[model samples]
Target: MLIPITREKFEQLIPLIATGPQYAYFWGKLPMVLKRLLISVVALVVIFLLGLAFGEGFYFFRLLFSIIAGLYWFWGPIYWASRRNLEIRRYKYSGFWRGRVLDVFVTDEIVGTEETVSNRGELVIVENRERRLNVEVGDETGFTTIMQGPLRRTHKGIAEGQVVEMLILSNQPDLGRIAKTSDIYIPRLNIWVSDYPYLQRVIFAQVSSQLSEAEERDYPDNRAVINRRRRR
Candidate 1:
C-alpha cells in the first residue's frame, strides 16, 4: 500500500540525530522534539561544567571554552538539517508505503574494506568478498523497485513471499510512481535493511498500525493478494 505524503510532513519525520534500531534500523526511535531537548540539556550541562572548570582568572581558557560551547551548540543541528535535506533533496516527492518481496537474487561480489591485520604485520587494506541480496519488491500500485542496502547485505535466508515494508520516493508525485526506496523493514524477520536512515521509525510504526487497522476494516477475499508491477 502506498500513501501520499507532503514534503513538509516528510521532513518532520526525519531525525536530527541518529536513533538506534527500531522500525527503521538506521533511524532512531524517538520523537524529534524530545531528542532535541535531550541533546540540548546534555550539551548545555557538559559545556557548563567545562566552562566552570576552565576557571575565572584565565581569559584564554574562557575564550576557548566559549568557542567550544558555541561550536557544540551550533554544529549538530545545522549538520543534521543539511544531511536530512541531502537525503530528500533529489526526491521531488515520496510516499509512506508497505509491500512484499517478490523475488531474491543473491550473488557473491568483491568488496573492499580497510581491515587491521593482527599479526607480525600492521594494518592492511583488503578486499572483502560478500554475497549481495537483491530484493525485488512491489505492491498493487503496478510499480516495482529494487532496494539495495549494506544493509543486511549478506544472504540471510530471505526468501520470496515475505512482507517488506518501507518508504518509497519519486522525482515526480503527479505521476504517482516510485523511483527510489529506503528504511526497509521485514516484519516477520524483524529486520531493517537500508543504505541510509530515512523515515522517523516511531511514526512509521504508527502508520503501519493504522494501515493494518484499515486493511482489517476493509474486508476482502480470503485468498492471498499477489503483488504485480505492470511493466512500463
Candidate 2:
C-alpha cells in the first residue's frame, strides 16, 4: 500500500541491530584495515628514506610523503570506520522488513561512472542523473512507515508503486527513524537488486532463492564500484 512519510508512521517501523565484528570503536581498525595501514606506512617510509639521497631535487617527494602520512594518521581510520559502519548497517538491512516503492525522484548531484572497454583503457563519464526513492514498509501489526533511500544508476527503470524491500536500522539511539537501503523486486529478473555495495549486490545475486524467481543478472552497468580499501 502507498504510504506517506509521517512522524507517527515512522515510529511504527522496526529497526534491525547489526550483529558482527565490533572493533575498538573509532580507534580500532579491522585486521585487514590494519594490514593495509601497515603496508602503507612501510611503503611511505621507504619512499621517504629514498628521497634523502636525492637532496633538494626530491623535495616534492618528501612533501608528498608528509601530506600522505598526515592524511593517513588523521583521516584514514575515520574513513575506515565510516565504511565499516555502512557494511554493518547493510548486514542489519539484510534482515529488514518488506516494503513497496511509493515514489522516485532524481537528485541534482552528478557522480562519475566508469567502464572498462574490451580493447580500450578505462572509460569514465559523469552521470548527471542520480535518483532517490520513498518506500512504504509495514510490520505484522500493519503499521507502516515511508522511508527514503538513494537510487543507484542500475535502478533507473524502477517505477513508482513497485514492490520494494527495506532494511532499516533497528537499534537507532540517535534518530527515531532511519532507512538504510532499499531493494527493488524485479519479477522478470526474479531477484532483488540495490546499489549500496557491490559485495552486497553479489551476495543478493547468489541468494536469489531467498528472494524471488528472477534470473541472475549482472550488477548495474556503468555504476561506480566503491572499493573502500583501494580508495585509501
Candidate 3:
C-alpha cells in the first residue's frame, strides 16, 4: 500500500526530533554524558587560568578558549545523539508504503551490554546471545527487503503473510527500488519494530487507521490488467 503524502507531512507525522518515551534511553547515557561534561568544564577552568597568566596575550588566549568550548559541544553528547537520530531519519524518503511479510527468521547474536565503565577508553561488555528477527516483506511494486529488529514484546507472534509497513526511500515514483527504510509498523498487531524509535507514535497511530482503511478499499487492478494481457 502506498499513500501520497507531502514531504512536509512526512516530517510532521514522523518527526526528526526524539520524543518522550525515547528520553528513557537518553537517561541511560546520563552517567557517561555527565562524566564528559565534568571533564570539559575542567578544561575550561584550566584554559581560563592559563589565559590570565598570559597577561599581554590574554585576549588571544580567551579567543582560543572560546573556540575550543564551541567545538566541544559538537564533540560531546549532542554529537552522539544527533548521529543516532540521523540513522533513524536516514535518506530522503517520499512514499509511505506497506507490504506483506513473506518470511520470518530468527537468530541469536552477540550484543553490547548497557553497563558502562568509567572513561579513558573504557571497557565494553558483551552478551553471549541476543535474539534477532529477520522479516522479509514486499510492497505492491514487488520490491522486497529484510527488516531486522531485536526479539521483544509481541514481536514473536509476527508471522508470514502479515501486513508490514515502512517509509520507502526511492527515486522512482513507482518505488521500483527500496534503498532505505524507516521503522516497520504492523497495524493489525499494533506492533512496531526498529533499532530506534523514529515515529511519533501518537500521531502515527491516528494516521495508520486511515491508511489501513484506504488499503482495504484498494484492489490489484494493475495485477488484473497484467494477467489479462498475458492471456491475450
lDDT of each: 0.63, 0.44, 0.67
Q: Which ten residues in a row have the lowest lDDT in candidate 1?
A: 223-232
Models 1 onward score TM values of 0.57, 0.35, 0.65
Candidate 2, position 207, lDDT: 37
What is the lDDT for 226 in model 2?
Answer: 17
Report the CA-based lDDT of candidate 3 relative to the real structure.
Answer: 0.67
Pull out the clashing pairs in model 1. Answer: 19-28
> Which candidate wins on TM-score?
3
Among all windows of ten consecutive residues in candidate 2, which has the lowest summed lDDT?
A: 14-23
As a TM-score, model 3 comes out at: 0.65
Q: Deviation in angstroms for 166 in model 2?
A: 4.1
Per-residue CA lDDT of candidate 2, range 1-232, in tens?
Answer: 1223233223222112211211223344355467557767886787788788888888987888767764574456456555654554443223334444445555444534444454456555535454555445454445466544455555566565454444444344432455444444443334444433222333333333333322112333322331221121
The better-scoring model by TM-score among 1 and 3 is: 3
Model 1's C-alpha root-mean-square deviation from the true structure amounts to 8.8
Residues 52-77, candidate 3, lDDT per residue (tens digit)? 88775688768777677745633554
Give candidate 1 regions above 4 Å deviation: 20-85, 109-125, 151-157, 219-232
